[model samples]
Target: MSAESSGGQTPVEYIQHHLTNLSVGEGFWSLNIDTLFFSIGLAVLFGWIAKKVGDSLDPDNPKGMQNVLEVIVEFVDSQVKDSFQGRNPLIGPLALTIFVWIILMNAMDLIPVDLLPWLASLIGIHYLKVVPTTDLSATFGMSFSIFALIMFYNFKVKGPAGFAKMFLFHPFSANNVVVKIILMPFNILMTTIEEIAKPVSMGLRLFGNMFAGELIFILIAILPFWIQWIPGGIWAIFHVVVITLQAFIFMLLTIVYLSIAHQSQDDH
Candidate 1:
């Protein structure tokens, strides 16, 4: 059938095409092809540039991309130093990774929501989500990775027994042994909930914002050509700021959560 004859490309089809990620498998096992490629590609590119800038540091003169990268590196270094007290070779790199990967994912929203999908449809592959942050799986995957890092640091800083004790007794401990025993389960439950909430909130927050933005863009694309440009242009401009701010916020929160998790029991 001709393109228009097949239900004239309904709104549902439009959205389904955009929301679908190019994947390798079925159901939950499905991978996000675009997200994986784009995130990794951007990480490598940004990392190489950052490293080159650092190695070629000129005390006498700094210009171009080197100058911009230096400011970013210095800012992130300062933040890591200010917040995380202990020695961690990983923290600075992890923060930079989060910042760059997320910003690149968010930047996909600027690529005209329909453009990539339209190209995909022409090739007989009907489903694709160009923006990785709009995919819950991608967002959660990143957040949970960060969560793993946080847990690692917690155990590394506190020791396994110390980390276990924090969860078992925690801020609700009692001096009496019997009372402490009674409250142990409750404390564990609370701690479990708190730990679980961190990754859930971190992932959902980014996913929700980007997904909502994508929906708005799709809705705008549905409007008449003449009127569509007005709202679409306005929202696109506003969304540039939104996407960047969200990336920065996600990075900041990741740092904050890691710092909190690494805190000593006495501090809590």
Candidate 2:
């Protein structure tokens, strides 16, 4: 069954409406305004809260939000310390930021699908996508940033000669000069594919999970209001676990990738 003529929108149309981003610009340079706004807004919110907690922190008398914030900090720090070896000073803070930012973005899925869109409608905005992780461009943008960092660390730790050797002589190197020449192209191709796959996989994984979750919520929204609660309530309960797990996976992979980059050739 489909929703009855919601402002002339069919069930499919309603879902599409919810999925559309409030975008600007055109073609290759287009920007999803809603995704950017919500993501940056949530990140700023987290920083403000963190700063307040830090300024007011009491060692012996931690309570309320202070205790909660401390727990989150310790948890992220522990994860980074355990997984990251030969770490930079930035790893712990980076892990914490990624974990918190992703959680906040994923948490947007828990909000009622129509609430924000309906509210935006009242203000004359037709489209407003609240969840940033559901946007592939946003997810890919983050993953590519991480990928660039990985590349930088690769060069820094291994040096240019060693990094170049990673591609040239990896996986299928030959001792013979002629044989090595024949294999060089193949080796480089495979290595390049492997390196590129990391960020593509990371970005797509988060985007796929979040997009599916958002789709389910939109589907629920088109159902009768009273009956909608059944699936909506169950999905909402289950999604808390999903959101947290996705954030943890992203953080853990980041630590592991950086750890691998920091390793010397002999470690493998």
Candidate 3:
């Protein structure tokens, strides 16, 4: 913690302050301003940079950021090509956006944990969380948005009857009409649980991993100033892998989920 934010607080207090957000209002109206600020700011910046770099394509001699971006685009496209069952023009770009945006947000955790909050405190903003993936609200927001797309594709590919078939006939079909009727409620219950589990698991997994990482950084910060660099340096090195893997896993799962949605029961 900086002199401004840390003040005379105990270690527990310091950690609490650092973990909290610059929130306002309460209940349904509540908002985490720092989470919104950083996540949206990074997204806008990413888009602007990508658009500028994209519009000035020099395929003959790509270099610097263009080379790096080309690598990332190709990597994301390859993953989509592998994971998605069929073709949807949107999947490649969506995967690229999710991967890069999440990686950018997760990268914020590498900033000396106290640095941004300290700076914010200097400007009279007391609480700030730089990492959006560490926040459940933000993670769930993205996951549920993906979940919506999953539903959309399910409808788009399978139609209303297909959805009903899955709900009523999946995992318990029968030649006899009476047996199929008997299994409808069970199939619907199981299918409902399966559907709910997807976004919940996805959101919680991202939140849990990133929150633990952030907490460790905070704990390292409260250590003796002189020796903090030892563990901090090691963990920062390892966290590069953690942040990148988290982004990739989220993006891959999104592709997989959408691909599954695109398949009809007969395809299964």
Candidate 4:
């Protein structure tokens, strides 16, 4: 057998190559195919599980998956009700979807980073990134979706005129004509900054955490075999908690953003 077919590449070289994303374009226009596929697949699977659990639930007798799902539903329901004062059927479901979908995506980190890609290479497909959150595009896409939802809720709850008024005079004085004139430009600048910062920060936060976790995993994979197992095992165990917490935090923030957008000025 050839050297290539003998012992094969070192684990470090194998993992480094796999971590690279399959991109289709340049800069911001670029798309990570692996991240997109894994994220969508996990989201669909979780959605199906949620539906099945709901269907299986019986008010008369509930246990196991049904009971766990009911608890999650109630928890999310209470959060939506407490934060948003409006009759929106969409809000509750949307929040639940975000929570479940994000958790499922984050859970992908629990799998061995090199497992699927290594298996794929056996069949001639070499590159695959299993953790979607590590992809900037995936996180940004989620945040952008939340941004759209915020705008929709803003218009739905406040109306065009009310939403416009918020931009003109918010978190500042527009009480007098002179004050309004002075503050209008500043208010617009601040409001614009705030709106832009929300989605960017939301996306970056998730991306940063996941990317760091992935990097650490890569670094650990590169260690000498004698020392590799120790750090790799420890980080993987700790990362299970980190990824889950990050997903939960991201979901909660989305709910909070929508809740804030839906509130009337006086409610603040």
Lowest lDDT 10-residue stretch of candidate 2: 1-10
Give me the displacement of residue 145 in model 2, in angstroms: 0.4
Q: Write the per-residue lDDT of candidate 3 for residues 1-268, one digit (tens) a residue.
A: 4323467788888888888888999977899999999999999999999989989999899988899999999899889988899989999989999999999999999999878877887889988999999999999999999999988888889999997887898877899999999999999999888887899999999999999999999998888777789999999999999999999999999999999999986874
Task: State model 2's lDDT.
Answer: 0.89
TM-score, cand. 2 vs. native: 0.96
Q: List candidate 2 segments past 4 Å from native.
A: none
Write model 2 residue lDDT over 75-167, tens digit each, in one string.
999998899989599898999999999999999999888778878989999999999999999999989999999899888999888798788
Q: Candidate 4's residue-wise lDDT over 151-186, tens digit each?
A: 887777788877876777865865689998788788
Query: What is candidate 1's lDDT per residue for 1-268, written digit by digit as tens?
Result: 2223334777777566567777898887887787787777777877788778778888789899877777777887887887776666877888877877787788888787667776777988667777878889888998999889888878877788889987899758899999999999999999988888899999999999999999888877777666778888999999988897888788888888888767886775
Each prediction's TM-score against the native? 0.89, 0.96, 0.96, 0.88
Full-model lDDT for every candidate:
0.81, 0.89, 0.90, 0.79
Question: Candidate 3 has which clashing residue pairs, if any?
Answer: none
Task: Identify the superior model by lDDT, candidate 1 or candidate 3.
Answer: 3
Model 3 misplaced stretches (Cα beyond 4 Å): 1-5
Residue range with the least summed lDDT across 10 consecutive positions in model 3: 1-10
Models ranked on lDDT: 3, 2, 1, 4
